[model samples]
Target: MDTEALRWFQLVCDGMTVTEVAHVHQVSQPAVSRSLARLEAEVGTPLLQKAGRLLRPTYAGAVFKRHVDALIHRLDDGLAALTELTDPRTGTVAVAFQLSLGTFLVPGMIESFREEYPRVRFRLEQSHDALGSSMVAGGRIDLEFTSRRPRNPAVRWERLFAQPLFLAVPRRHRLARRREVSLADAAEEDFVMLRPSWELRTLSEQLCADAGFEPRVAFEVDDLPVVHGFVAAGLGVAIVPATEGEPQPVGAAAALVRLTDAGAFRDIGVAWSRERRLLPSAELFRRHVLALKGGRMPTATA
Candidate 1:
């Protein structure tokens, strides 16, 4: 429990002889042994046991050292984060969003933001589209990118642009040959879907319901890449947004069919708390992203 005793114990674990630990601490060998004995007494167990004339840590001593080391490291990190928070140019940005948004939005935003504030640090938290909105509302995140505008009055949404969904199928599949596929035609086949709670999942379900039937969900996953992977593997077809760099052609494995009949598009936008004004770094980031000549993100709503 004593700090000095803990330090001596660490030295012992590092292979310091009791005589050497005593010498470093400017104490006698008896003093070192008494400190170790007192520590063992307080802990109700022997932290070290005699191995011939040398001492070695017992199992409990090894575990305790690991715990102490981790605690000390975390304390150091906590202090560093506190210091970072007080400096605008060097603060941490906690931005949360869905993976699709990360692929489409964060890269551009980060590149521009870093150009102006090279010292700014970031902590990204990615979740499903639906979950990102909730994170902003719950005060667990600083900013969020969501496909659907938040309905909760506690948060504010700014409509950036529509990310239209498209049908993706293996290139060799019959539907892949179409110039643009209708949802009705594609709905008849097996489909890989996002989980029902996701914004994309809810939208996909609604689009299929409008066509007069629920999609026969052949496989469901939260990750969009996995959806693409499934389509590439010939497991089932899927619907995904036409992200600018998307459908990274899987070696004749998949093709994208713009779904004209689905008549559905996810509104992509940024959201933050209505009660809080934008921080300087956040405002800088917003202005940079919106200033692009043809970029979708626009000014925040009033």
Candidate 2:
């Protein structure tokens, strides 16, 4: 398995003809074919077979390509990391955060960080809340800004702060005028809940149970904002996080009543793999986040 043969084979698997590959590589068609043959011989199988006028990978070739694709991806990441290691200013930090935190929470932190490290690069992903722990543990990302605690042994979660949760009701609802209310007060109301897989869904359910009644779920949704929308539409009440200062009609439409329950806040945290060391840029960003413990995230203007 020569590297040149592997590259040529990969291109063919991507539907390149031998002539086209030769044209791209500025090599003779015979040269490309010879490379493919040697590659197949090394693997003890025909990697490509004629399908009419076109060439396609055999089942074994396709499986080999899958692993090759992963290897190539890891290789690219390694090269990038090597370059970054020599030049810390150009290092990239990979981050995964909850969609709920994207609007301002995560963005604000990133904005502030860039102020100090303007040339540092970042790769960001918006992940579902429940996926944070698993993503970090699996090495899919360097760090995750999440509200849920990681249950995996290889992952560590450090609480940055506790964000207060609220009971959101339609603006015209009778209880909207109150500054605070107990979970039991909403016991008889229809609930708009996030899907069962969401940790917030489970937390809301447990809160209701502690209040001595089960929530009669009227709507099931996929995300936090949708739950807010459903609650604002008067479909049902919901448990929601406090809105940022940014003007959101959805926030304005849904009157937030502070929950009187003892545990009405969720711990906001950054999670990372304990089994793996962080890259230089990632470690810097993690330290920056830790420095902000119990402080508000700096806005874009700041």
Candidate 3:
């Protein structure tokens, strides 16, 4: 049905003569009358009745007017919401990141962003690099922080910085006091690491390969905290990001030894689908991350 004709029918029902509605709308009276006629034909009923000099809506017209009023109100609201989403100061940014970054990096960034954009809101999702990359490609997330660059052609990956990888061992371990250690140094030691599906695990394996040894897998876990707990309990040592291996306590529950091997770093960056257009807020957040200074890798002390 024609929305404009329905609107004209509603105006005629509001105690305005057909000629008056035409005058208000700057259209001919016959044009207005034909619109109402089309509306009545479309609904297969009489929508208005001539009551003396004024036109009043019939029962069917009143019912149709209610539905039209609701549809128009919803359309107006949708347009307003679109305007707000495109507004730089009021839009919402949806972000996805690896679970490890949620501990410190993402939260700190969000807090700083909020300081600058108090009215903007955020929707955050935590997943592994693979899944986070998929979310960005599928347009489920506007932006993603991930260690692995997405291989999909439709997604764009911007390398923010490389985070140094560290060897996490129990506090009392002999190498814990060492300022730097090679992966080959722990070749014989049992290794606790994330599942192979995680990008960090692949990076760690490659690092071990570069160090000239295959690490004996002792435990396979998905959670970062669990990996840390197993290492702290002396089960085995694991190569983890500097941020993840940083000592949380003053004395250190586990010691983070710097890897002496060359190219011992994981590249982290923001990813988004080129096919999707980011909201103003998401674009601003992306710029904020790209503009961040050094310290992508937290310093680990022996």
Error of 1 at 237 (Å): 1.4
Error of 2 at 24 (Å): 34
lDDT (10s digit) by residue, model 1, range 196-287: 76778888888888877888999988778888888988988888887655325335367888888646677777778887666666666656
Candidate 3 C-alpha lDDT tens digits along 42-82: 88999788889988888988898888888878877998999
- All candidates in order of lDDT, best leading: 2, 3, 1
Q: Which parts of model 3 have CA positions greater than 4 angstroms off?
A: 4-38, 51-54, 130-133, 244-252, 293-302
Evaluation by lDDT, superior candidate among 1 and 3: 3
lDDT of 2 by residue, 118-195 (tens): 888878987877533457887869889898788898899888877778999999999999999999999999999988
- After superposition, candidate 1 runs with Cα above 4 Å error: 1-87, 131-133, 247-252, 290-302
Every candidate's lDDT: 0.76, 0.84, 0.82
lDDT for 47 (candidate 2) = 80
Q: State the weakest 10-residue window (summed lDDT) of model 3.
A: 293-302
In candidate 2, residue 169 scores what lDDT? Answer: 96
Clashes of each: 0, 0, 0
Model 1 weakest lDDT span, ten residues long: 293-302
Best-matching candidate per lDDT: 2
Better of 1 and 2 by TM-score: 2
Clashing pairs in 3: none
